[model samples]
Target: MKNVKLISLALSMLICFVVSAQERTITGTISDKSGQALPGVNVQIQKTKKSATTDFDGKYNIQAQKGDVILITFIGYQNQTKTIGDENIINVVLQEDNQSLQEVVVTTAMASKKRKATKSSTQMVQGKVAGVAISSGYVQYAPSQSIVVRDVVSLSPKNEPLYILDGVPVKSDQFAKINPNDIQDVKVLKDKDATSTYGSKASNGVVVIDTKNGIYKNLTEKELDAKLNIVHPAPTPNQEDYDAFVENAFESPKTAPLSTFSIDVDNASYTNIRRFINNGQAVPKDAVRVEEMVNFFKYNYPQPKDQHPFSINTELSDSPWNTKNQILRIGLQGKNIATENLPASNMVFLIDVSGSMEDDNKLPLLIQSMKILVNELRAKDNVAIVVYAGAAGLVLPPTSGDEKETINDALESLQAGGSTAGGAGIELAYKIAAENFIKDGNNRVILATDGDFNVGSSSNSDMEKLIEQKRKTGVFLTCLGYGMGNYKDSKMETLADKGNGNYAYIDNIQEANRFLGKEFKGSMFAIAKDVKIQIEFNPKQVQAYRLIGYENRKLRPEDFKNDAIDAGELGSNHTVTALYEIIPAGVESDYLNQQPDALKYTKVQETANNYNDELATIKFRYKKPDGDKSIEMVNVIPNKTVALNKASDDFKFSTAVAWFGLKLRDSKLISNKSTTDILKLAKQGLSRDSEGYKAEFIRLVESAKNVL
Candidate 1:
């Protein structure tokens, strides 16, 4: 009887063990906000303590009896407990928890608040942001100064920013064509940290433009919906050219022989004259430095009536990096079209000739560029030149717009030198402009340089304060960038934003024509200000995601209000684009697995409608610069990720370009990147290429590959 009982008990024990061994298995991954793996977390069965610690992947395995509780714990994190119900597998992510009293970093315009720091270095800090390259082709127009934020089309090999200009997703680069005089300011965001809100495309960067409007009169629907046409006259003879022609025409051969500055001729009172402008001295009564006067004067053109085409007219000269012995000329149908003999116009040609401006594409391009504007001068405009080297100095004085010879001599006389004293140069330029304050005419300083204000007065706050002070004088600023290496793009954009001006990057002649000639008001005249863009993602319509660019342009949840925060402007035909990469739910792969410990800690909640596939909705708020009211524009983008093969040429090209930038910066996020990919994308996207944009992309790709 005892033997029989033992046999039955052993059989019973074996049956129970067999039942316990039939448990189910589940799998997944664990990560932090930046997608890095989490490790060493504790994952366990809640009531029974039957548990497992997360392996290197924060993954775990456990056996629960029917219904069981699972609890997870980690340092500096809240403990999470979950019940194992009908679900076979569970995944999680533990969120960081910080007390309200804990010290943190808060970014303010003026200063940085660091609660803990061993030491600090003298690094330059500013509020300007960076842009993700859209395409090697558009790179020809990369850092395009016009910072309008609207382009919804996928990246083409030649597409610019994808901000919706006016209404559609036009290339925000259109803003680059407007005259700075028409704009009130511009702001840019360049890093993922600042622009994540706009998603993948913004991952490249984001630009905000501020335009100027008239008094508070609200327009009708027709007025609001009216198509805007931004047209600027050709860069014929602006004030600079006018002065040169005038000086040349009025040789005064009969007068006493003039003193040449450095000719085996003379270096006479030029330095003294330089010192005078530095000291804010009035123009000497008998001294005629035509270039100075042309740059320092202002012109008030009759605003075109609403019925006529809104036109823009201005000239910007991009000079050679080294001004010694260089000759380049651009001519057109006429000179500054001044009906009343070239009115007493005030002009500021803000030149950015920094060390970064050393390349042929930069300083050299600038020198040649200035010739275009010099060709478009009228006798009435007055000009001045304030240059920043290691420090600021007056390269030229306020001379008559009619003194063409004098102006040309002054322009041809400059040479590349030490560090960029952009800040000092700006300070002097504004002072000169303010001192010669024009009542109602146009007073603008046109800055030409690669956007790098590194050495002195390089703080964001300092620049902001200085610009505000200058703007109070009702004087405007415009930025013209030259070169590629070490381009301080974010910096140039920020100054333009604060100075109520426009920003542009000139890579070649066509760009100059498009900007200095084609779109003046959109670039210079501000039609709006404090433009705000908000993208709301419907959680029900999307899954896991990331914003690719515009890292630095991210706004705090609260910045959309209070009326004090600044934004970007819009130019006619401007297109801005924002792209997002989505990770679809239920599409499980190795990339989706999380460790058991992390899963226990993370309590992810997904609603039933999470597969809407709609990426995000865009909302825009803007105020007419000179007015008191606000306006808006909005759009929606569905969440769709096509095979890389089917993507738009613009999209593919942009992706390739972004890959190149990542390679340049050695970023780990982008992988398997090469010139081959760029070439491939360009080949795939080159449909109906315009102005050789697609061809250029191919050329650049070949060049990069060849050099490699």
Candidate 2:
């Protein structure tokens, strides 16, 4: 009886241990009482270091055992604690804490001795705060200065923090003009503290100042507005332009058996569209290039084993948006040649230093991007710098890549000014590239610009003609677009398309790293040139088909065989993906509403006896980087189709991207699928996302749903 009691007590102790150690995921959304999603809210499991921050969508997840308490805190909101219960999800709404917000403990304590020694208020706070940033628009003593506390919350048009003197709101200029001797105490209110007190005007935070003899007066909104002469600036007009092209339409395979187009490796559209979504602006319909967006991501495919430089992959699956129709994905994986195996390179940095490039995102970003590429170069590689403003000039002569200091010095010395002579810059850059060209090596000109050309052959047609002429010299072009508000995307696209080059938009430093650092070899080294894809669908298998995206890259059926015809280049380690929406034979789709009437004189015929299982035959033509002639390879896609759930991650991800592009374009062909569906499909293919790009894409979709 004692042995039995001992065994039963041990078993009970083990059960208790398991229950205490078990943990489950707790997910919730953090928002304010106004239903506005509050991002960056800190949530912590009580008495534990485990914590999570709300994402841009105001959602967070943490692991905790049942009965554990979670503490939630945001700067301007009241702190709340919730005990984890049987429910897996616990959402908490925080209320405004006006009382606690009224007193803000100074983030940086200023010593009285230092304050006395300082000449101005700016100096008093310059180095005191850990997070505050101070900058002078003019001279050091100039009244045009700006002070920021923590992150900017989009208050004024210039994103400046609100300045409150005594009880009256003042501008930064007024704050700067105040005498340091008259100031008594200064407090910085940030995050929710400022937002809740001053409302939207203090969204960027507030800098409250108390003067020796200043009076505090309660003024009405109208009185405050009149005192500040607050004229809300009109929205700046967007001067950006994109190449307009109609989305590809469905065609009957009986009438048009072959679909041909040039392969595009450029990812400019995806990044440009991302910029729009991030800025909470509607993406322009013309800016949505489905193929570019789909091809931006790399897919897992076997490398070529033969003499060819790329491998072909094909998959047929049920359409995600439409049930009756099917989708065909064609992927090409460019052989990844190691950096050591790459040929020597002769590169020219063609930069536009035009007055329009004065923005921080323009000329400055271009120089930083070039520096990244320079760091990757070997001793065998050489680069020359060419700048164009009023006229083109050689800022740096051809220097070996090993001379990093010299190259960076020249890049740093560049300043933006004068009119844009883009055509002349291109001419000079190509000349330099051709002169320093290495035999059987990578010869290219990297053009960094906002694509705004106002002087000397500035028209798009003129630029196209010039680029076409330069392409004959065996030099490639890589266009890197920068800046906004006057970005000429059409001009950049024209130059890239005609100059035998790829295009990318460098919106931020991270993008520079992505294009120039992580993707150095793929963006700079071309393995094959004039790469084209032509598809011949079996009429018996496919009734109507439409090539998604590539509306501007379509080629004539005869062009596929013509060696003289120019096409896109395949860079080393680059992957290109294309999608074709197909209406199988006997299956109907609304996309075929405008199908042409059957021919009366000629009858459509199909000989499927031998190739009954074949859905289509894909033909790829590409030329060796230095070779004149083209080599062709063919692959046959089987008629077999997999369910959407069973498709490869590459197919599902690419399809989700294409579908999102269609939705952005408001294409009538696709069903009215919401962004939620896109998000779900994208998450299904999140495998092998080591770079976290797929996860970022999911967040982008979430953001788009709210804005779109």
Candidate 3:
């Protein structure tokens, strides 16, 4: 009996040892050999029932007994098993299940892309992706019936898919401004099944935007084939005080300065004055307005093409309203780094004394963070301040220009919570600058608030029109934006653009310093205004080309010469990048049209003889607001066909952004583009992010994979 008990106990002890020895965690990635994510890939302890399917990202968090046998199985990819590994992150690549690995109808960020899709989602959705819409600022007051998926971001609260630009959850809760040109592509992941990766965060769905990496930031330009235009002129304009009209007139700068407006004697056929007087059209051709038509062109400044390695093409033309108002703009470009004159001097302060500006992003940081810029101000500069909340007034007006003290005091007293009339505060500031306007000064009006113009004349349209009128007074504008929860980025951008100003977000202290101190040139000072570029195809030189992202900025060919047509301004060191995807005609695919005239229809045939020349010829025009004459430039791209697949990293990176943008909008125009192709190309094209943007891209891609 004693011997039997000992043997039984020994067996029990052995069983315990065996169970203890099975304690181990096996981890690995589950993907198909072709590099496709395999969701529902079951991972478990071989003998136990413990298992978990891969999350949308093909990622699983699981634990098993040591040295335990693990099983991984997916519906299509071949099953995989590995012993317990010590590594923290385990990635698995699964092989196709042959009979099971059918085609996939992967919905990538709301856009459907085929992935060997055995499912019916092939050929993408018939018309437009689901749940997308276009919110055009040009037509905000106009009710739109269009569905989702527009290239431009909508300011309205609803239907804006969550943005994970470069992985930073997109700080655009309110008035988050993103440069369409800066974005790579926006993947709209709208479906619950597709966006479930983020749980509640993705409940609103997600859009993954990959932005332009400072391409080739690490390498010197190899070919340097890009041609750019360099601009130079007088002192920079004051964008903030864009409205200080000598509210009193003093004549000194120009002798016998003519009134800004004149009757169109050349265009008007009537030489008799009395006949025209009845129409209110001949009021007083002598009403001389400011030369800077509206807020857009009141000032002229120099651009740095010499300090940088970029080239420029300049264009000159007569203003459509009055040939006396010559129009000039320069295109400064480069393959990389865009060696151009960048901004370096700037001082902006936010006086957050308002009830509406109290939110975290809106006014608190807006007030506390002037230290970022205050600390970086140079001895060559001066700072000014004007504050208004309950009343239109100035707390500090252009101090002997102690920038440090001026910025600090302005930041110290700023607070939110009361009716604010932004218009009144801004007006008081210019009154002070008129006395302090620097002869060649970079005079500016830096308004920091929630943009609530409630106190007096605060309507967005009213503010824009007023600021537009103010710019003629010759003080430019710069807006330092803060506060969220009802931030009006659309309104602010309008005010800034019309004021010949630049706008930036103070998401954090780092961004504050970057804009106010570090990147001073690119943020302040205008090098050119109303820049317009027109490419006239030698119908013989090329068959078809696409303007990638500036869909909203497209100008009527005739407007290219009309000085009145407003265009985006370029700051020193600022780069305006654009891309065109082209397809040469006669390559077998019919790019032209052949619709016969049926019932009221028309048919036209134009031969591809125009495709005979090289690539395309580019035309550009600009005017020095002060100089009576306009300056112009042009460049012709040779028809030499560079391999599309072998485009430069810059070209490739830009190309990827465009492809994704099209996908986000569900544009069927760009043929044969796929989610996988974008990923494949971007894998090798990613550039380092000194600004943390690159890291955000990787995370966005990983998030995008779950949806696709």
Clashing pairs in model 2?
Answer: 76-192, 76-193
- Lowest-scoring 10 consecutive residues by lDDT in candidate 2? 108-117
Candidate 2 per-residue lDDT over residues 1-708, each given as its tens digit: 999999999999999889867888898888988797776688999888677667555777788998899999975468999998899888889985444221223432122222322235445455554334334311122234356555523333345566776656765655655555555555766666765455444555677766555533344444545554555568789999998888888888788889999999999999999989887888989988998889888899889898889998889999988878999999888999999999999999999998998666787678778878998999999999999999999999999999998998788677778999988998899989988888899999999999999999999999999999999999999999998789999999898888889999998766786789779989999999999999999888898899999998999999999999999999999999999999999885667766667788777664548477999999999999888899999998999999999999888998999999999999988875778889889999888864456887898899898667
Q: Which stretches of model 3 miss by more than 4 angstroms?
A: 1-331, 334-352, 400-403, 587-611, 623-629, 666-676, 704-708
Model 2 regions lying over 4 Å from their true place: 1-232, 594-601, 605-610
Reference-based TM-score, model 1:
0.43
Per-model TM values vs. the true structure:
0.43, 0.73, 0.49
TM-score of 2: 0.73
Q: Please give, for residues 141-217, the per-residue lDDT of candidate 1 as tens digits.
A: 23534322223432222223334222122344353443434333233343443233333344334443333441111
* lDDT for each candidate structure: 0.46, 0.82, 0.46
Candidate 3 lDDT, 1-708, residue by residue in tens: 999999999999999998877655444456766676555467877877566556444656566654555677753246777666556456878764334223323254435554432113322322344443223211011133322433344422344445554434533321134443443333445555433443333434455544456221122222111211212256354112111111112111112111111100010011111112222232222111111111111111234445332355433322121212222222354213232322223233436467766554565466545655555445655566666678765555444434565556555555455677677777776666555665544556677765556668766678878888766655667776664444555556567666756655465444454465555554555555555667654434334444443433456666666766555555554554444434344433333344234333332245655445545566666543222233445667555543435544444443454444444334545454566776665555565333333333334443444333
Off-target runs (Cα >4 Å) in candidate 1 are: 1-346, 352-365, 374-384, 389-409, 416-421, 432-443, 450-461, 468-476, 482-526, 589-614, 625-630, 638-649, 663-667, 671-674, 706-708
Cα RMSD (angstroms) for every candidate in the order listed: 35.7, 12.6, 25.3
Ranked candidates (TM-score, high to low): 2, 3, 1
